[model samples]
Target: MIEVLYFAWVRERIGVPRERIETEAATVMDLINELKLREERYAWAFDDLTSLRVAVDQELSGFDAALAGVREIAFFPPMTGG
Candidate 1:
């Protein structure tokens, strides 16, 4: 199981801060497609990949990044510098 964390509007849209997911996804994009199939909320939250950011095992990664042995995945909006 992988720990999936949602932040900001993602959390609001998904109605949860985090969850444990049992997946057979090969990459982050595959994981997202799995989630998107689960519910409309997930679909909306992940609708625009360009407006979101992702992290795998606490390190920044892209949608095509492999999910092999990844224990955690986090999704959040892009951060802004002050």
Candidate 2:
């Protein structure tokens, strides 16, 4: 099982802050595909990959990142600094 965390607008859209999922996905995108199949809320939350950022086990990562040993994944909008 992996802990998936949704932040900012993602949390609002998905209607949850976090969840534990049992998946056999190999990559983040694979996991996302599984989620999108589950419900419209998840589909909307992950609609645009370009508008979102991901982290694996608290470290920033790409969608192609392997989920082999990852225990947590976080989704949020891209951060901007002034």
Candidate 3:
């Protein structure tokens, strides 16, 4: 199972802060696709990949990043501050 976390608007859009799910996805992109198929909320939340950032087990990673052995995955908008 993978613990999925949502931050900022992502949380608001998904209507949840986090969840643990069992998936057969091989990568972050695959996981996002799976979630998107689950419902319209998920589809909208992940509609624009370029506007979001992802982390695999607390470390930044790309959509194509492998999910093998990963325990956590987080999705959120890009941080902005000076």
Winning candidate number (TM-score): 3
Give each model's whole-structure lDDT.
0.97, 0.98, 0.98
Q: Sort every candidate by lDDT, greatest first.
A: 3, 2, 1
Clashes (backbone N, CA, C under 3 Å), per candidate, total 0, 0, 0
Query: Where is model 1 more than 4 Å wrong at Cα?
Result: none
Per-residue CA lDDT of model 3 for 1-82, tens digit only, reads 9999999999999999999999999999999999999999999999999999999999999999999999999999999999
Every model's TM-score: 0.98, 0.98, 0.99
Off by over 4 Å in 3: none
lDDT of 2 at 35: 99
lDDT of 1 by residue, 6-77 (tens): 999999999999999999999999999999999999999999999999999999999999999999999999
Against the correct fold, how does model 1 do in TM-score? 0.98
Per TM-score, what order, best first? 3, 1, 2
RMSD in Å for all candidates:
0.5, 0.5, 0.4
